[model samples]
Target: MSSIKSPRQIAESLTELWSPRVVAEVDDAYIKVAKVQGSLAWHSHEGEDELFFILKGRLRIEMDDGAVELGEGEMFVVPKGVRHNPVAESECQLMLIERKTTQHTGNVVTEKTRSLSDQLRPV
Candidate 1:
């Protein structure tokens, strides 16, 4: 059966900052949503590209080469092997599209890093 999922409602329902919950899956990728603020640790996916879609507020993706700022309804894709850090001065909501094998924090693990099991939970 098919169901409807609202990214806005799911994103707004999130209680933990930086913790993304798996909302849906599209073949090899998982579509996720999270409410975030502040800066997440720098990390890079070795073999997968990650996509970020800003749902609310603004986001600044700090890259080694340059930084990209995204406002509401904007989206960006961070290519594989590119080191990047996501930052939001204020609370922000976003949708993330990543391969099932893509690690949440990539090679670097911090206190904020969330596991696949953790992400595959109900919001």
Candidate 2:
């Protein structure tokens, strides 16, 4: 049976910033939701690209090349091995799609990092 999930509801239920909750899965990729604010550490995923879909507010993905701004209902894909950081001037809701093995913080682990196990818990 397929379970119906609401990314917005899950994102809103999140009590921790930058902590993503797994809401669904498609093959080897996991669909996750997160409530974000401020900035996340600069990092890169060497083996998998990350997909970010904006659900609410605005998001700016900063890279050495430049920064890409995304508004509600927009999406962006950060290629593998690219150094990037996600930033939101205000609280933003986001949905992410990435390989199951993708690290929460890529190569840079911070105090805000949450493990995959933690992300799998119920929202």
Candidate 3:
């Protein structure tokens, strides 16, 4: 049987910035946690929507349409095909819900990008 998981605890245990670790799964989506600072590339998933829930610090998601700021306990969802960049002025911990096939950086690959195999690593 599967055990219960603590998203915040798992997120806090991560040592790598911008690298996400899978925490759980629900149907077609994977629940993940990440420790981030600075910025992730501007990109969009052609077929998957990405949801972000703040667990610790602040984050600003910049998009062509506008930008949204999220604080601890807040959340946001970036629709599929919408280009967005997630930035954090200081270290922030967050939970992410995304389709299993969602690309880490969408269509843009950079040094910070992590493949599905990498994200699937044990937390």
Which prediction has the highest lDDT against the true structure? 1
Q: Model 3, residue 65: what's the lDDT?
A: 91
User: In model 1, what lDDT does residue 109 have?
Assistant: 99
Worst 10 residues of 3 by lDDT: 4-13
Q: Per-residue lDDT tens digits of candidate 3, residues 4-117?
A: 888999999999999999999999999999999999999999999999999999999999999999999999999999999999999999999999999999999999999999
The local distance difference test score of model 1 is 0.97
After aligning candidate 3 to the native by TM-score, how far in Å is the CA of 62 from where it should be?
0.2
Off by over 4 Å in 1: none
Residue ranges of candidate 3 with Cα displaced over 4 Å: none
lDDT of 1 by residue, 1-107 (tens): 76998998899999999999999999999999999999999999999999999999999999999999999999999999999999999999999999999999999
Best by TM-score: 1
Ranking by lDDT: 1, 3, 2
- What ranges in model 2 sit over 4 Å off? none
CA shift of 65, model 1, Å: 0.5
